[model samples]
Target: KTPVATLALAAETLENKHIVEKPDKLATYAGIVKYQSDHLSKQIEKLLRFAHTESGRLHLAKTTVDMHELIRESITHLMPLIQQKNATLQLNLNAAKSCMLADRDYMIIMITNLIENAIKYSKEPVIIITTINTPEHFILSITDNGIGIEKRHIKKLFRKFYRIRNNEEYVAKGFGIGLTIVRKIVSAHTGKIYVESVPAKGSTFTVELPGLK
Candidate 1:
């Protein structure tokens, strides 16, 4: 209801106002609608699925997905955030192996969350996404030069609603369930995810899912 109302209000505002001359205002409103719509859609779908599933576990529908294309799609969805942070997104999708057997929607969610996670933690973050096919698995790495996770916290990062900072130490605020959902998505595909980081240097998240035969 709120999302639909917001959308209607935005459309009405655009129709009533003359933003044609001010490209900046026009772009900001446009971006707002896009962000709100995307957020509402993702949340609604998750809520619907949760309501439907008896076990509360995410259901999977396997299909052949190209990793390069998936990352590109996720990046497109995150343009507003990317621009807001003045962050440069680098993609290294040159690897020969790019296919994965997974659920497209869930993979997109997983990748989107991971990318957003990286963007928030890093200062003047340069986000690098690399994907390739390995002999036994498809490898996806998201590397960022940001404040790295502490050794103790690294192990508990996947725990639901667990946050890293205690008010003073954390710069950005989050619900802290993004990685939990990402972990669930990877686990559903029987994949492995790991993180390596140094305190001030940066952090890298690596995911390896069994390759399609």
Candidate 2:
């Protein structure tokens, strides 16, 4: 069932008088209601942003953003998903110059999307996030021990609403717009994104942006 349907069913159960008599069942349904509501809200918000991106009306409120701090915050925000997946996050923030001019909110969304993708697709998620500051560029790389993409699919991964069809029994639930938004955000900041993967091994996504002035 979709999130909306699940939320409706959960809400109806919560309103049942008999549910109040079973505290454990009540709690479980209540949790479902909350989780589904959150999931629906997030999906709606992503769709709205995608519409804005498509219309070319997406605006960025530029500011000085600390990449390390933003990365840490993104990890914190996704801690629940990480723990649920038994994921291990290794942060290698080696960049001496960690600050850059970018839209803070968009950066947060982009970083969160990347990390969340890693966690969702991997069986045993071990994500390594690394940052490097070069003389002319700031590079952020996220590596995941996940079901790696094929070379043919990698090029199309950022296309709007494009999803890879695989034979796996379990597939991640998404509208397939997350990476599209990520790529748009990176492009708005005049950055370049790349991916490297070998089938059955893993994948690495790297975003390169202009160094701090």
Give the residue spans of candidate 2 off by over 4 A: 8-29
Q: How well does model 1 score by local distance difference test? A: 0.81
**TM-score list, all predictions:** 0.79, 0.89
State each model's CA lDDT, in order. 0.81, 0.88
- Candidate 1 lDDT, 14-83, residue by residue in tens: 7855774588988877877996687677667654544454366778988999878999999998887788
Per-model tally of clashing residue pairs:
0, 0
Highest TM-score against the true fold, candidate: 2
In model 2, the worst 10-residue window by lDDT is 164-173
